[model samples]
Target: MNEHQRRLLTAAGLTELRFDAPMSECCTLRAGGTAAALIDVQSIEELRRLLALLTDEEIKFLVIGRGSNLLVTDSGYSGAIIRLKGECNALAVQERGPDFALVKAGAGCALGKLVSWCGGQGLAGLEFLAGIPGSVGGAVRMNAGAWGQETGALLFAIELVDKDGRIRQISVDALRLSYRNLALADGELGSSILTAAWFRLTADEPEQIRSRCAAYLERRKGKQPAGAASAGSFFKNPPGDFAGRLIEAAGLKGASCGAAMISPVHGNFLVNTGDATAADILALAEQVQAEVFARFGIRLEPEVKIIRDESCQ
Candidate 1:
């Protein structure tokens, strides 16, 4: 560990700190290597203090949610990992209009749980996100969507803490949401930390909303593999085309690279067939992308967020 990490450990008074906390323990894929340091913040104040300290020490760090839709490198992250699992889980409903309600959710709130809660309360507009597996903050960051709807469409505003730990609110219009991208601009160190989001929803019959969510869940079950360690969809669907169809057409289904196989059930999902590493999944993804490009001349883009050393190779 570096000097900054050592100082953080001493300041936090944490004895359970691991030199290399295994990446597999924190991600949905259950793959990847260790992080330089892992710290769990359990409150807003704690998160704020930690962020301020990191900034003062000039230590690079990342804020992680539930770790869904992410892939870490086998070489590992050489910076501090700030986990927001227990700290930002607040969720509540606020009145907007007679027939409309504003759903206020913390960044760490489970996306699926929020969807289910809204659906059970007869709230519409979140049904399309019924099967997405990630935290509310991640969904907002990625503009996560399904079945012709996106999280950005219903979002009223988002609360964020900038690099210097200053809190600010940004409206939906400022979020330049397009496809799987959000307003969180790249290239800026410690750009912003999503705190909470407010979504507008319309009231409907509870049963009707539940029925829709159930149907979407059923559809996902039929299309996605169950009981497997996979990071959801591997690639984003190209415009007017599907990634699954392209991979299947390229005959890359069931292709394996060191126990990481393109799931036969769904061509776009790469599954860890027990003991698969981040290298295996990445290799398979590269091969699939190459083959798909070779056959159809359409480049496939990954939906999974890869966090690792870009300078590795």
Candidate 2:
């Protein structure tokens, strides 16, 4: 099935397909095994065609962007990995007024780059996402937030492809966006592939917007570990209490399992100390969950998407 899909994709004009592609190069964690195949898609037409081929051949696939929040297992993925490239990296202002503007961005645009673009253009409201990692698609799907503002608050609409290959323009309300999650009309989590998104932002002085971005970046620098391999915060804050505070309160800061450790700089962060394996990280996370649950009665939920399956090996 996978071979048939690959041949079809190649015949359809994709030449950047790789077999046993290194996952470490793709994810932020910097530690993961190879995948079965990785396909670099250049345009929407190519994606549509490739997805059709995969669907017809019954080959399992996952779409990825920047791979910031992904944690791949050491055993590797046994399915196709589709990555957006080229034309999907666009960011442009669709409509502009004295006090507001509608910025339309491609799904593969880096969240940080989008924020920076807005700052440079004197657009405000996305300053909170200044240093946040991942692409616009991933941000929208996860409702990625920082400070007090979330991605959903600024999202006006999204163009996404449904399971049946139907392209739909959905309003923010239709997505039912919530804290770190998006839901469908059926009350289930959404799995649509986002192609682009429109965000509403207020017009501000570029200097003012840059100042706010600087402040946010500085705050992140002070609180989060820099120059290390990590998937941002390991766990989401549970309700009113922060996961960092809980893990710190449980005395797990700087705790280690092999080379993976709870960062001393931030208890909510799990860092890969050069040689940490996915298993090591998972073990440390489990230990942190157990200790925090026992002490504070709050079971920490991982924010990082741990990609693993029976076929990982």
Candidate 3:
């Protein structure tokens, strides 16, 4: 780390710092270079200070969630990676009406845990998140969805630290939402770090909600690859067609480059068989994209967030 990096930490009073934290360990794909630092922020005040310093210094950074839907390059990130924890993962539920209830969750709350919590609380409308391996913040940022439901649909409001380090509460109606994307109405995309979210759910039988959640998980396990190191659903579905179907039609299933391979069970998954590098995964994805475009005339967009070290460029 340079002077700016050291200064950022010292000035912010952040303690949980890991220098040169390996992206291979942080990301679900299990590959990539080391980050300059990974800081586990413990409170909103800490985050505000750190974010302000980061902005003042013009440092590039990522406010990571569960790191499930990210792919960092082998050259690694040159800036800090901030992960919310401690009080940032708190959960609270309140009865709003006869059938309506409001659930407040910290951005760091695990999607699976939130789904389970909702089921235990007899809260419906979150069963679609049963098996998603990420945090609420990531889901809301990407508008993550499965089985015909998206996270944006259940959101009432969200609290986030803006680029200038001002925390603001924005309603769902004030945002521009679409397939796998949630953009700020008046700001640039990714200009804030989500701290918490408010979800409005309807009451239901706990047993029934649990059963529905279980069924979704079971269906997900049956359809998607299991126990493989993969960034889930690598490509977004083009209009009127699925990326997986396109990859399959292009005969790219089970294709390998180094230790990286397209998952045989699900064409959308780019898997690390064992020791695949970030380069291997990226190369395979590009190949898949080329082939799919050549055969179908539709370019598949990536759903997974790809982070390249700009310094290397």
For this target, which candidate reaches the highest lDDT against the unseen true structure? Answer: 3
For each candidate in the order shown, give its overall lDDT on alpha carbons: 0.84, 0.85, 0.89
* Model 3 per-residue lDDT tens digits across residues 51-148: 88888778777899988999899998888899999889988995567898999999998998898888888889999988889999999898999999
- Per-residue lDDT value at 52 in model 2: 78
Candidate 2 C-alpha error for residue 184, in Å: 2.3
Residue clash pairs of candidate 2: none
Residue 60's C-alpha lDDT in candidate 3?
73
Top candidate by TM-score: 3
| Model 2 per-residue lDDT tens digits across residues 138-183 | 8887889999889989989988875557788888777787788867
Worst 10 residues of 3 by lDDT: 4-13
Q: Give the TM-score of candidate 2.
A: 0.95
Is candidate 2 or 3 superior in TM-score? 3
Candidate 3 to truth, TM = 0.96
RMSD of 2: 1.6
